[model samples]
Target: MLLSLFTVLLWGQQKETQEQLERRKQQILIEIKSVQQLLQNERTKERNILAEIEEQNRKINLSRQLIKNVQQQITITNASIKKNQKEADELQAELYKLKEDYAATILKTYKSRSNQSRIMFILSSDNFLQAYKRIQYLKQYADFRKEQGQEVKAKSEELSKALVRLEEQRESQKKLLAEQQQNEKNLQKDLDQQKGLMAIVQKDQKKYNDQIKKKQDETKAIDRKIQQLIREAIEEANRKAREAAAKAGKETTKSVGSGKNATFELTPEGKIVANSFKANMGKLPWPVEKGYISLPYGDQPHPVQTHLTIHNSGVEITTEGGSKARSVFQGEVLQVQVMPGGNKAVLIQHGDYITVYQNLSEVYVKKGDAVALKQSIGTIAANSTGKTVLKFLLSHNTDINNPQLWLSRSN
Candidate 1:
């Protein structure tokens, strides 16, 4: 009985693990589909080789992940199959033993089946007390036979169920194996396409390198401007606070320094907002509703040019064309920056923390406008390549942070 309980618990855990894996695999597949659709849309427009390569790379990565997930599922199914097979064998053996013992009991009863034999056996007792004891013993023996028969029936049913489970597991393993094969085939195709694109890129490495360098320079300029704006915003907020304190006839609060060392001197209300934003770290909504991170934060090697490193102050999320950028949290709009390329950005202040939504074609909320969570702030501009990408940045005072860390995982 203990062994059976342990087996049940083990099966339950494995089943749960399998279910989790299946859900993850399905999610990956959905993401792959989304990426493919984006890639198709890009193809309909003028080709941007770099953007195409990035999209392809994303699809390849998802494919590899799907393959890995399926492999894990196959591993689990194999283990389950093996376990069930062992259990079924054990049940068969137990059933065989039960049948053997029950047959022996039946044979013994058959030899004493005559009513006279049973009556005589009880009558032949040396005294009335002995006869009564004999009758009780016969009754107990009959009860034992009935219980043995019942146990045999139960064992037979258990064995049948085990066999059925074993067969089902085998079928599931077969299906998983087929699915894994298809995923491998698709992955191979993706690799082949990637190789073709890489070959084309290798021929004109210098041109692509120059493009990457130009883009990097633009990014650096943007980052510098963003930092400057954040510092200015900080100084402005602090200046207002100082004036308010002076009017109230209180001693002027000490300045919080300048540049990278700048910090917000929060008021009582500002402190609450700052604290709330900080407390909700990693639980904030995504800046966009239906998008995926095309580029992550920090310095990483370029996807096409591995020799070149790219620095990102924040993440870039690629979404459907014409998708509106939304606020991740409730905050007051601090600035509306119009870049050199005519693209606009909305900077929102949640106390000392600021979130920037860049690459906007239009802005809905102006400077000082109060925005609620998930409020549509602006429309993300689609580039000539037909790709709509949002450059999202997060900062505490003037210090930059990885926005991906603050955004929820579902994004």
Candidate 2:
């Protein structure tokens, strides 16, 4: 009984794990499909080789992940199949023993089948007390026979169910194996496509390198401008705080620090908002409803040009065209930065922390506008390559942080 309970608990855990894997696989597939659509859109327009390659690289990575997920599922299925087979065998053995015992009991009862024989056996007792004891023995024997029959029936049914379950598990394993094979084929196709793209990229290394460098320079300029804006916002907030303290005739020196240090002197309300934002780290929602991180934060090697290093102050999330950017938390809009390309960026202040949503074609909220969590701030602009990417940045005062670290994993 203990072994059965343990097996049940083990199966429950494994089943839950399998379910989680399946859900993850589905999510990956959905993302792959979304990326595929973006690639198709890119194809419809003038070809931007670098952009195409990047999208292709993203798809290839997703394909590899999908294949890995399928492989894990197959592994789990195989284990379940093996476990079920062992269980079926054990049930069969137990059922066989039950039948054997039940047959013996039936045979013994058959030998004294007549009611008269049972009565005579009880009458043959020498005294009244002996006869009573003999009758009680007969009654117990009958009850034992009945219970043995029921036990045999129950064991038979249990064995049948086990066998059925074993067969089902075997079938499931077969289906999983087939699914794995198909995923491998799809992955191979993606890899082949990636190789071809890499070959094309290698043929004109200098041109692509120059293009990458130019883009990197533009990004660096934007990042610098963003940092300057954040510093200015911090200074402005601190300036206001100092003035308020001075007007109230309070000690401004202790209440508000110098803005040169790149920190905000928080008011009681500001402190609450800042504390709340800090407390919800890693629990913040994505700025876009449907998107994935195309580029991560900090310095990293370029996707195609591994020799070249790329620095990103924030994560670039690629989403469907025309998708609106939203605020991850409640905050007041600090600035609306308009870039040279006519695109805009909205900077929101949650106390000392600032969240920047860049690459927006249109802004919904202006400076000093109070915004709620998940409020639509602007529509993300699609680049020449037809890819709508949002450059999302997070900072505490003037200190940069990885937005990916703050955003919820479910995104």
- Among these predicted structures, which one has the highest lDDT? 1
**What lDDT score is found at residue 252 in candidate 2?**
34
**What are the TM-scores, per candidate, against the unseen true structure?**
0.90, 0.93
- Give a tens-digit lDDT track for model 1, residues 132-247: 99999999999999999999999999999989988888889899999999999999998998898888889998898888888888889988888888888888878877788779
TM-score of structure candidate 1? 0.90
lDDT by residue for model 2 over 221-287, one digit each (tens)? Answer: 8888888888888887777878887898754323334443578877777889999999999999999
- State each model's CA lDDT, in order: 0.89, 0.87
